[model samples]
Target: MGRRTPKKKSREIYNAWNQTCWIKGVTVNPMVTLEYNEWWSRRVNDNISRPNLEEARSIEEYLRVVPSELEIIKQDFKKKTSELEKKIEQLEEENVYLKLDVDL
Candidate 1:
C-alpha cells in the first residue's frame, strides 16, 4: 500500500545507477553502489524526491579509471614488446654476419 512508495523510490535509484554503470562499461561494485545508496538517502533530506540522473552519471565517470592491474599489464606489455623487437634486430644482424662469413 503506502509502503510501496519508499521501496519504489529506492529501486529508481538502483535502476539509474545500474543503467549508468552499464553505459560506462564498468562493473557495478558493491562499494560504489552502497555509496550511491547513501547519497540518495542524504538527498532525500534535502527535499530531492526522485533519483538523480546526474549523480548516477557522475559516479560512473568517477569509477571509470583503468584498474591498477590493467595499467601494470599495459606497461609490462610495452616493455616485453620492445625487448622482443630488439632481440629480433640483434638476431638479424648476427644472421647477416654469419652469411658474410659463409661467403668468405
Candidate 2:
C-alpha cells in the first residue's frame, strides 16, 4: 500500500477506534463528543517506551515480586530473635550448673 499521511493514519485509527459506538439512526461526530476527544488526546499522548518482544519476559516472570524491605527485615528479625532465645536458654542452663556447683 502507498504510504499513508499522518493525518489519514490518525483518522483511520479514530474510525477503527470508534467503530463500535455506531448507532442505527443517529450519526455522531467523534470530534464533537467529550468522550472521543478525551480518548483521542490520551491515544495521542499515551506513547510509552516498552521492551521489544525479544526483551519481553513471560507473564509469570513479569508478575513475580521480590521481597519488600519490610518483609526482609521481618525475616531477619525473626531469625535474630530465635538465635537470641537459644542463647538465653544456653545461658540459663549455665547458670543452673553454676548454682549446683556452689551448692555442692
User: Which model scores highest in TM-score?
Assistant: 2
Candidate 2 deviant stretches above 4 angstroms = 1-62
Clash number by candidate, in order: 0, 0
Report the C-alpha displacement of residue 17, candidate 2, in angstroms: 26
Span of ten consecutive residues with least summed lDDT in model 1: 23-32
Residue-level lDDT of model 1, residues 28-96, one tens digit each, is 453477779899888888895769776667767788877699889999999999999999999999999
lDDT of each: 0.86, 0.86
Candidate 2 per-residue lDDT, tens place, 1-104, comes to 88999999999989976775655224556337788789888888777666699988999998899899999999999999999999999999999999999999
